[model samples]
Target: MYLCSTMKKYVDVILPLPLNGTYTYAVPDDLSLSVEAGCRVVVPFGKKKYYTAIISNVHYCPPSEYEVKELFAVLDDSPVLLPLQYRFWQWLSGYYLCPLGDVYKAAMLRG
Candidate 1:
């Protein structure tokens, strides 16, 4: 039998602001079991602000350029945005020449 080993997990998230690309954050051990793609998470973005962002991808590759930040909180027990919906949003962002955050903003609009 093969033994399973735990690896470092990272999440790429789409912030609600008008941004171009996803941001990566490190998953703390306490939140690792529950954090996943499409889940909303609270992350500290700028020096003085924290934003609620949507997780777009989860993987083990750590970014080589910058120091990854730790996620503050997980907002959902399950995925809020489905995989299919994420692809559609990606298409919309590309076709419309807008930021993914813009697509996310319009899609998540509340009345």
Candidate 2:
């Protein structure tokens, strides 16, 4: 007999706000196949508010500090942000001493 196992997945998203660090959200099984880095996902930000955030990383490791929330929805079937653009934003944020969210806001067009 063989044993099968499933691993829990999570994503680190970059919200377009003037805040530092990425937020980790749980990837529901239904959305796991669609979630990827560079893709935008709707997630709860604070009490009574939701925000569209860009996925920065996808992994199985769960955060040990705070309670992780489930993703609200996936905005794109494919990644809207290119890999190069994502890296550029990271570099710009680090070099300029600004938050990644600020870089993302300035780089992306408003909808």
lDDT of all the models against the reference? Answer: 0.89, 0.88
If scored against the real structure, what TM-score would every candidate get?
Answer: 0.90, 0.90
Instruction: Please give the lDDT score at residue 10 for candidate 2.
Output: 89
Clash total of candidate 1: 0
Regions more than 4 Å wrong, model 2: 1-6
Each model's number of backbone clashes?
0, 0
Mind giving the per-residue lDDT tens digits that candidate 2 earns over 1-111? 212235888899999999998988999999999998889999998998998899999888778778889999999989999899888888999999999999988888576
| Superposed Cα deviation of residue 15, candidate 1 (Å) | 0.5
Q: After superposition, how far is residue 26 of candidate 2 from its true place, in Å?
A: 0.1
Compose the digit string of candidate 1's lDDT tens values, residues 1-111: 212234888899999888999988989989999998989999999897998899999888878778889999999999999999999999999999999998988898554
Q: How many backbone clashes does candidate 2 have?
A: 0
Output the lDDT of residue 76, model 1: 97
